[model samples]
Target: MAKQAKNHAHRRMTHQRQVISDCLKTLNHPTVDEIQTCVIRTAPTINKATIYRTMNRMVEDGEVIRIVGDDGAFHYDATLDAHYHMLCEECGALSDVDMPVLPQIDQYFPPDSDFRLTGHDVIFRGICSKCRAKKAGRNRAETGQN
Candidate 1:
């Protein structure tokens, strides 16, 4: 019975972890508050503290990454691999940008360079397609009235 109880507990934790992982996977870069809202939708019994603790543990284990945006909100991403992020200034949308040549930059640096470079983060901020279209529509409307 004791073994069965332990197994049940493990399963429960696994379920919670899966819920968090799925939430991150669906959203490109979700803030902690957003993730908490998602967690509630899936698992109402899960508390905010538990979600926070799990996210911290996942970051330490390299299962996820915590990105601090200009808004001061910490966002979570499940993609642990190195890649650049593009953020929409207008809509706050986050998307991944693929650059095959990014890895070649490392070769240019000296092997024994005094500075240690583990990785790099490149974030491009601009208005996204939707926001740009909206702005154009507004301009057209104003011109039509004139």
Candidate 2:
């Protein structure tokens, strides 16, 4: 079961919610539009408002995490594990970064501050290998170099 939403009862997993969750897991990191597009394949009647409400509820229930991509759109992630991600600047691709979680960084919060540091999000931005290769190929073609 997903974590309960604060001040609200735990929402039961309905058929539509299950479908949404499964789609989220299958996707690497997808935005609402991407998710809705994928969802319509299995659930033809699901609408945009339903997707929005369900996603927002999932986030509130701790079943999903919303990340803002370079494109300035909200991306959904179901992987609750503590890890970072790499966003491809060239293609707007988002993928998990395979590395250990730096829990030590949590200690950096002001020692005397009253606020508690719950978590942190680290996103590395750059041109992914595929994008770099594509660019390189284009440059080579333009320059008449093999």
Candidate 3:
């Protein structure tokens, strides 16, 4: 029984490594289905259940970061660096926002408070520059102004 358990764990770890490798290659944060698709190309025998289980484990272990997109779907990213996500409201585009960590904000809650500060995920939602420019152009055209 112990040997069986060991083999199972080994297989899971192997699949997880492949999943993480595929995730790193993806530039954009992809959903579980997308990750599974990528893994399938390299590992034809890997099933969706294994992919999902491995991904969830990776997220829990902090090997991968999970972001809940503006569309409410979970997306995975392998970048461990501290960063936030920006969602373009008009175009539904998601991009990384590189900025300094604001650890000082946790002090505002008062150290004696019941709330224990751990971490934060900040997602800025606004129209991207391209979307704003497109809207402006449409407005000008509607107003009959070149």
* Candidate number achieving the greatest lDDT relative to the actual structure: 2
Candidate 1 vs 3: which has more TM-score: 1
> How many residue pairs clash in all the candidates, one count each?
0, 0, 0
| Residue runs of model 1 more than 4 Å from their true location after superposition | 1-11, 107-114
**Mind giving the per-residue lDDT tens digits that candidate 3 earns over 70-92?**
77877788888888888888766
Candidate 3 overall lDDT versus native: 0.78
Query: Per-residue lDDT of 16-73 in model 2, one digit per residue for the tens?
Result: 7988998998888998888988899999888888899999999999999999998798
Worst 10 residues of 2 by lDDT: 4-13
Our tally of clashes for model 2 stands at 0
The local distance difference test score of each candidate is 0.85, 0.88, 0.78
User: Deviation in angstroms for 5 in model 2?
Assistant: 24
Give stretches of model 3 more than 4 Å off: 1-5, 90-92, 110-112, 128-146
- Deviation from native of the Cα of residue 41 in model 1, angstroms: 2.0
Per-model TM-score versus the true fold:
0.79, 0.84, 0.71
